[model samples]
Each structure stands twice: as structure tokens, then as C-alpha cells.
Target: MPSIAYILSAIGIAAGITFILRLIPFGIKSILKDNKLIADLAAWIPMGAILILGVYVMAEIDYSSTTTALPYLIAAVVTVLVHSWRKNIALSLLIGTATCVVLANWVF
Candidate 1:
């Protein structure tokens, strides 16, 4: 085991780091509040997230054959169409999920 002095020194260092880390959020809170950059991030991040999800999902699809691609393709097309018509994220996601599940399990 380590010496008591060594353990105390380590604990002191850890406590100092933790105190600084916890102090930082409050330190920057005023600067971040009502910032235009932060407002833009809140508005655009959702679409960016959705686009990243779409690209990641598309990248995983096996496009080598029709049997593998049809379910995903039909689901994507249905999702896009539903989103276009209704502009409802939850409904589009639900319908797309249902379509993929049914097609993947029952038909394909």
C-alpha cells in the first residue's frame, strides 16, 4: 500500500480538480446565455442530428442485392413522404418504424 502522505497528496489533487471542474459551468453561464451562436445551435442541431442519423443508417445498409435493400428503401421513401405531407416527426418515425418492422419480418 502507498504511504499516508502519498494518499493525502493524491486526494488533495483530486479535490482541487473536481472543484475547478464544477466551478466552470457557473463561470461561463452568463456568457453563454442569450448568445446568438447558442441560439443558432439550438435551432439547427435537430436537423443536423437527423441528417447524421440518416447518413449513418444509410451507410450500414447492404446495397448489394434487392432483397436486402427493399425494406429499407421502402421505409425511407415512406418516411420522407409522410414527413413531407404531415411535417410530424413522431408520426413519421412511428410509421417508418412500423413499415420497416412489417416488411422486414413478414414480407422480406
Candidate 2:
């Protein structure tokens, strides 16, 4: 088991590094206000960040056991299909989770 002090120290270090990195872009924007290229690139940063996170989540899935993943896979697929059909994220998520629970027990 990990110690609380080590966990807190790691968390603090991570937060501090992230905060400093975030400030770099803002500082650059101020210094290069007249550069349209820099501004245009910065505009796509959010989309790039989202794409990176999405890929990370997808890539991190454990495929070694179907038992744990099947439910989540079913839920995600149901969520997408329901959202596509009904155009309601909240309803889709709720129904997806219910379907996943039912399917999990039914299949596995």
C-alpha cells in the first residue's frame, strides 16, 4: 500500500507542473499578439486536447477479460445508438446503463 504523504507529494508535484505548463501558452499569447499563425494554432489546442484524451481513454481499455469490459462496451454502444436515435444524451446514458446491467447478467 502507498503512504498518504507520498501520494500527496506526487499530487502536489503534478498540479504544480500542470499549472506552470498552462501558463506558458498564455504568456506566449500575450507576447505574440500580432502573430496570426500562433493564434490560429492556439484555437485548435482545445480540439487537440479532446482528441488526445479520447484516444487515451480508448487505448487504455483492458481487453484481457470480457467479464469486466462487456458491460461497459454494451453501455457505450447503447449510449451512442440511443443518442443517435433520440438525440438526448441524458436519456441515452440512463437507458444505456440499464441495458448494460441487464445485458451483463443475461450474457455473462
Q: Against the true structure, whose TM-score is highest?
A: 1
Which portions of model 2 miss their true places by more than 4 Å?
1-61
Model 1 weakest lDDT span, ten residues long = 64-73
Candidate 1 residue 49 C-alpha distance from true site, Å: 1.0
Report, for all candidates in order, the number of backbone clashes: 0, 0
lDDT of 2 at 10: 97
**True-structure RMSD, every candidate:** 3.4, 8.9
Per-residue lDDT tens digits of candidate 1, residues 22-50? 99999998989989998999999988998
Candidate 2 lDDT tens digits, 28-94: 7778998888889888986687558546855776778888677768777887799899987568768
